[model samples]
Target: SSDLSDEDKIDQKGIRNSPYFKPDWSPELLSNGNYITHFCVYKNNVIEELKGFRGDYSGSQDYDLVLRATDKERKIEHISKILYGWRQILGSAALSTSSKPYAYNVAITALEDKIKRNGYDGKVQQITDTFFYRTKYEYGNPTVSIIMPVLEDLEILKKCILSIKKNTTHKSYEIIIVDHLHKKKELESILGNNCTIIKFDEKYQNSKVYNSGARVANGEYLLFLDPNLEIITNNWIESMLEVGFISKVGAVGCLLFNNNGQIYHAGKILGLDGICSNALEGRKHDNMYFGIANAIRNCSAVSGKCIMIKKNVFDSIDGWDENLFQYFNDVDLCLRIYESGYRVAYTPYVKLQKQNQITDDFSNEIDQRKLFIKKWKHVLEKPDPYYNENLSHVNGGYFLTSSPPLPRLMTLLLEVYYERIDLQTQFPEVAEGDYSNLLKWVINEGIINDSYMVTLAPFDKDFEILLQKYSQ
Candidate 1:
């Protein structure tokens, strides 16, 4: 913006994606901060009716105006085109909130005012070291059912329960441990007065285990967690409830970290490396990669473990899918909620340290994965709406993609189409990969098995990114 010239405006897009800007217009988006002011237009009547701005909150006047305007209406849409540029000069708010510390409290005031106007008993607190804010609500201190699934690892459960009891500030929550192997008396000995136990026999890990736990849930919200996680954030439930209370959000998840304090699950990304996986695992738990780690944004899915959902929403989905015996059940649940017209959100406001997961065999998960792909291929075959198509899953980090979406898809199609054919020398410049072999193998598979996965996974997310990019 300092170089707001015609040529510079043309090149403004260079710093436009990731860690700088992403297009989100939901009330949840504005609740954290304003993304609607730069190079934006509004109806004169709307602005006038909202009473332009107050000099009292001069440092964050733009943010105040944005909150007031958006608070009036949530039916908003994004144009998905770059029309603004903000300069990150010294002593300017654009260089992060530290540039003008006064703006921080002003933004909180604006947010709390909006929350108060909405008839919610909530308080907004800024996330330290970042510009983002998190809202925590009382709602008369509703009980939250903490449903955790575990094996016979009583030691892990004990450590986790003790941590929860120590760290959690919200007292009105119950812990329901759904055990596959019987450990009732032992579980009772370790847990506190509010704890309940549910026993079940399941051969493999999946969301179905939560069904029995849900039946016994006495709380207004259901918190599905893994027994292996050590609770870190004191306000985990309140943070989740803040987002879940939003009428449009079905579920909320938080930043789950390995013992090393690295990100384990912030959310789920569909079609990463031809499979669905946790979001931003490559980044440290607190690393502000494009501000994604802290911001509460809609995700394609959040981890079923460490996810919280309203009891009503959980029942509406008929609970977790029982068909999934092992993998991707969490994603299936979130996507089903998404299909039913609700958003899944991820927040870093609540942090938990999970025991390191040792996936000795990626091959064993393939069967459940194929089933997951078949069941939710519609969503999988399209680019994740929450994940930016311009960002890539290379080297397991969300870095800028080497190429744009369209060309990437075209190149893949050419690769698959050219894999078996003797066309490599014909197109000397074309990049080569295993795409044609995959297509051919899939075709042969369809011929042999008659009609399923071969056709299901051929285009994969490459076509997904292409369609989403061009369609938008």
Candidate 2:
């Protein structure tokens, strides 16, 4: 161990030439396998199985083996320290080696056959890539107003602000704290001039409170922060802001982790088994979505903990609906934006410290039911005809509701005089696209049928006017 001779020098060629020499992942990747070293020192039953078990697959065989062993018995203690080593023995790609490819094929076939035996459908598409932030900063940093609506959790709120102040790479920003539903005394002492604290009656609704703050926000960009959330990394604001700069991006959310460091939200997965959980749950920090190092992928919707949008976008959608007090607000906003031909995306660079967690200790049935009803009314009643049951949220809820009047009018105007394609030349491209898509989606969702077509002409002028105002 004390050898300091010249012979002890690491072979630079070996280090540099090795195919597996990915500095970012090599250290942690080797550490995950270090437990093998302790096998010689301690006699363990589990070690015996691991040694005996034929993990013949390539690349991920060890990882899969470990997973299998853990699933059998979760009682094993995690060796948090680095103890094992994995050197560059071969290229990481399994198909590169004949034997390894055979092994992987066999493993995959076995897995598929097992799933078939268990009556599982193998038609699902695995999301291999995830949405991440752009490093180029193509949008350039714009002044952003970080609006936080606080109710309680003063400690976490302070931490949240501090994290933002210290970690954010984007320098031009201000924090607006909406102190409505909680005592503001604790918050008063901690806030700096960078922050503007607004007092309002305890409303308990984030939508309305956020709207109130947006009305006063002076920045070109608006970011919504929940009090319980804290920023976890540098460049978080920049990541979200870049997305906001995209003309079609309506909202952008980041990954969220709870107090325990477990992932609370990676990105929203719509149209999953009646409910959706974080994309990758309980994964160690590096083993997350982009793998051990860094990467980005797209998601359906980002978490509410940290969502950023253009100020114009916020106003264009009329901000958050005050009727939605607490829950399903984000989903509601996302749906509206999506309908308006904009995208709701999840980027990788933003890391939010999530505070709200579903816990076993407390019973929130009453509130939960209220939230469910408020959020999924379309799914429950199927009253809106534009609802496509297959389009997520409602297996049948989307088709039930009737088309709103404005959308119907626009569609009829388009159909009655197909010659008026160049009509309303004053409207912007986005405005034209928005009106067209809203009409199309409403029709596609089956909200209005042929019988409902006659009433379109009367409101065409009004619809165009509103479209200009909304999309401007």
Clash count, candidate 2: 23
lDDT, candidate 2, 130-245, per-residue tens: 21112232455578999987755677777777888888777789899888755666777987668888887864567778988898898998888877777777877776765456
Quick one: best lDDT, which candidate? 1
Q: Local distance difference test, per candidate?
A: 0.68, 0.50
lDDT tens readout by residue for model 1, 136-178: 8766678899988775567887888888888778768898888
Task: Report the lDDT of model 2 for residue 116.
Answer: 50
**Cα RMSD for candidate 2?**
22.0
Q: What TM-score quantifies how close candidate 2 is to the native fold? A: 0.50
Supply candidate 1's per-residue lDDT for 58. Answer: 84
Name the candidate that leads on TM-score. Answer: 1
Give candidate 1 regions above 4 Å deviation: 1-21, 43-57, 72-75, 89-91, 201-205, 356-364, 395-397, 406-441, 444-472
Q: Which parts of model 2 have CA positions greater than 4 angstroms off? A: 1-135, 181-185, 273-277, 282-295, 355-472
